[model samples]
Target: MITMQYRIVLPADYDMAIIRKRIAERGHLTDDFPRLAFKAYLYADRTAAYAKDRENLYAPFYLWRDTEGMNAFLGGAGFAGVIDSFGRPVVNTWSVWHAQVATDLSIATYATREIAPIAHHIALGELRDTEHARVQEDVERGALAAVTAFDPTHWTLLRFRLWRNVVEVADKNIDVYQVGHISQPSAKHDS
Candidate 1:
């Protein structure tokens, strides 16, 4: 599996309702898209009651079965619409080492992503195993969904998780967002 995300920082005064409406109206377009595992429509409002930062942003995260699906979406009109509205964004991608989802993914209301750099001396194989185990433990406990991926290009590891409720995280490197919608294209295969 592959994980991808692109963030677009909006103006401080930007109205976030526009993004909400956009998700409500078009988020389902990918519901049954081929080779797509899931798409999480996520956004953050600086003015929201639970916001931890003062920067508004529209960022969507995706899990794909392979590069074929990822490439198809990027070449499609849906992506074109995004470029038309927000200009082109620098998309970040990682090779997934582990992914687990609960039976009810629709209950996910919040999402968190943490990116950390891997030290030069660390064994990549061992690091991947450790992160995979951690994610399994998290999902077994109560996490709605969890994924661990790494980008060798930058030697960065990404830890992403979905929760059914709001969470208070103090880590400066972690980004939290409210989930507007989730498109599980391959719902039958989710586990």
Candidate 2:
């Protein structure tokens, strides 16, 4: 599977209601999209007390069944619409090692993402195993969904999770976003 995200940082004075309305209107277009696992429509409000900094943005995260699905979405009008609205964005993708979502994912209203560098000399097998285990532990601790993946180009590991409430992480680099909606074609899965 693959994980993808594109973050579009808006102006400090940008109104987030525009993003919320867009999601309310168009987020469901991909509800039954082929080969899609889920799409987390996420955004951050700079004015919110929970915000790490004063930077408003609309960043959507996606989990695809394969490259074919990823390519199809990128080439489709849905992506074109994004380009028209926000201009082109630097889309980031990672090869997923693990992904799992609870049966009742609708209650997930918040999401978190952490990106950490992978050591060049580290044992990849061991690293993958360790990250996979961590994801399992997070699920057991009440995460509604979790994904562990890595980008070979950047040698960075990405840990993403969905939750029912806002969660604070000790890692200062972690990004927290409010989930506007979730588009899950498969609906439920574990892997």
Model 1, total clashes:
0
Off by over 4 Å in 2: 188-191
lDDT of 2 by residue, 1-191 (tens): 99999999999999899999999999999888889888999999998866867489899999999999999999999999999999999999999999888766778899999999999899989999999999999999889999999999999999999999998776778889999989887664432
How far residue 61's Cα lies from its native spot in candidate 2, in Å, is: 0.3
RMSD of each: 1.7, 2.2
Q: Please give the lDDT score at residue 7 for candidate 2.
A: 98
TM-score to native of every candidate shown: 0.95, 0.95
lDDT of 1 by residue, 1-191 (tens): 99999999999999899999999999988888888888999998998755765579899999999999999999998899999999999999999999996655788999989999999999999998999899988887678899999999999999999989888788878888999999896664565
Cα misplacement distance, residue 98 of candidate 2 (Å): 0.9
